[model samples]
Target chain A: MYLAKIKVTYKPSVLDPQGEVIKSALHRLDYETVEQVIQGKYFEVRLSADSLAAANGLVESMTEALLINQNTETYNYTVEEVEA
Target chain B: MYLAKIKVTYKPSVLDPQGEVIKSALHRLDYETVEQVIQGKYFEVRLSADSLAAANGLVESMTEALLINQNTETYNYTVEEVEA
Candidate 1:
C-alpha cells in the first residue's frame, strides 16, 4: 500500500486568519520565540499502487485537481510505502 | 531558526465527513484504486530557538495546550533548523 502525506498551505500573499489566531494563542501561552503560524490542510491518503512512481503520479494529479486551490494555495507531498 | 511541520488528525473512532466527501469526489474522478482519505489540519510553525531541543519542547507544549484536542485528535510533528 502507498501512503501519501499531503500538505496544502495558503500562498505567502494570502491572509490566513486562522493561522494568525493560532499564533496569538501560542503567544498568549508565553511562546514568544515562535512566529508566523500558518494553518492549512492535511490529507492522509492511502491507496493500493504498483509502485512509488505510480502513487506519486496519481497523488500529484489529485492535488492539482481537487486537494488544493491553485490560485491561493501551494502544496507539497511525500509518498511512502507501508505494509498492508 | 526552527521550522515545525505538525499534523493533527481525527482519531479512528471519530467521524471525518470532510475526508469522506473528498474521497467521494476522487471516486467520481475515477480514482477507484485509492481509498480511505482522512483530512485534518496542517500547521507550519516558524520560530527563533537556540536549539532544536528547545524548539521541540515549546512546540510540543503548544501542541498539547492549543494545537491538538487530545480527546479526539492525534498529532505528530517534525522539527528542523532552517535558514532565516
Candidate 2:
C-alpha cells in the first residue's frame, strides 16, 4: 500500500473570498500582523497498488481529471510507500 | 513569522464528487486497486506576530470565520516558528 498526499489551491492572482474572510477575522482578533490569508485543500489517499510506478500513474490521472480544475486550480501530490 | 498549515476536508458521510471522478480516472489508468478517493484542501499561511500566543489566537478565529465552514467541514492547523 501507498499513501498519496494531494494538495489543491486557487491561482494566486485570483481573489479568494474565503481568504478575505479569514483575514478580516484575524484583524478582529487583533492579529493585525497577518498580511494575507489564503485557503486551500489537502487530501491523504490510500492506494492498493502493488507497485509504486502503477500508483503514481493512477494518482496523476486522478489529479488531472478530478482533484483539480485545470483552468483555475493547480494540484501537486506525493506518494509514500507504507509498510505492510 | 509563524507558518500555519491548515487542512480542510468534506464530512465523511457526504459524497465527494471530485473524489469519485478521480477514482474513475485511476481505473482508466489501470490502477484498479484503488477502492476509494477522498479530496480535500491544504493551506500555508505566514503570520507576522511577535508572539506565538498572538498568532494562535488569530488562526483560531480565522478558522472559525472563514477557513472552514463549521457546518459542513472541519479544519485543523499547526503553527511553526521560523527563524528570522
Candidate 3:
C-alpha cells in the first residue's frame, strides 16, 4: 500500500481572509509574536499501487483533478510505501 | 523565527463523513485502488520567539487553545527555526 499525505494551500498572491481572521484572533488573544498564518487542507489517502511511481502518479492526478481549484489553490504531496 | 507546520485530524474512533464522501467520489472517478481517505486541517504558522524552546511552547499553547477542539480532534506539529 501507499500512503499519500497531501496539503493544499493558496497561492502566495491569493488573499486568505480566513487566515487573516485567525491571525487577528491570535493577536487579540495576546500571541503578539505571531507574524503570519496560512491555513490549508490536509488529506491522507491510502491506496494499493504496483510501485512508488504509480502511487505518485495516482496522487498527483487525483489531487489536481478533484481536490484543488487550479486557479486559486495548489497542492503538494508525499507518497510513501506502507505495509498493507 | 520559527515555522510550525501543524496537522489536525479526527481521533481514530471518530467517524469522518467528509472522508467517506471523498472516497466514494474517488471510486466513482475510477480510483478503485483507493482504500481509505482521511481529511484534515493544516496550518503553517510563522512566529518570532526568543529561542527554539520558546517557539515550540508558543506553537503548542496557541494550537491547543485556539485551533483544535479537544473532544474530537488532535493535532501534531513540527517546528523549525528559520532565518529571520
Best by lDDT: 3
- After superposition, which runs of candidate 2 have C-alpha atoms over 4 Å from their true positions? B10-31, B52-61, B64-66, B69-74, B81-84
Error of 2 at A78 (Å): 2.2
Determine which window of 10 residues in candidate 3 chain B has minimal summed lDDT. Answer: B75-84
Q: What does TM-score give for chain A of every model?
A: 0.91, 0.87, 0.97
Q: Which stretches of candidate 1 lie over 4 Å from their true place?
A: none
Residue B31, candidate 3: Cα error in Å is: 0.5
TM-score of each: 0.94, 0.71, 0.98
Residue pairs with colliding backbones in model 3 are: none
What is candidate 3's lDDT per residue for A1-84, written digit by digit as tens?
Answer: 999999999999999988888899999999999999999999999999999999999999999888999999998899999999
Error of 1 at B26 (Å): 0.7
lDDT scores for all predictions? 0.93, 0.76, 0.95
The candidate that wins on TM-score is 3
Among the numbered candidates, top DockQ falls to: 3
Clash pairs, candidate 2, are A40-B42, A41-B41, A41-B42, A42-B40, A42-B41, A42-B42
Candidate 3, DockQ to 2 decimals? 0.93
| DockQ of all predictions against the true structure, Cα-based | 0.86, 0.53, 0.93
Number of clashing residue pairs in every model? Answer: 0, 6, 0
Ordered from best to worst TM-score, the candidate numbers read 3, 1, 2
lDDT of 1 by residue, A38-69 (tens): 99999989988889999999999988999999
Candidate number with the higher TM-score (2 or 3): 3
Task: For candidate 1, give the lDDT.
Answer: 0.93
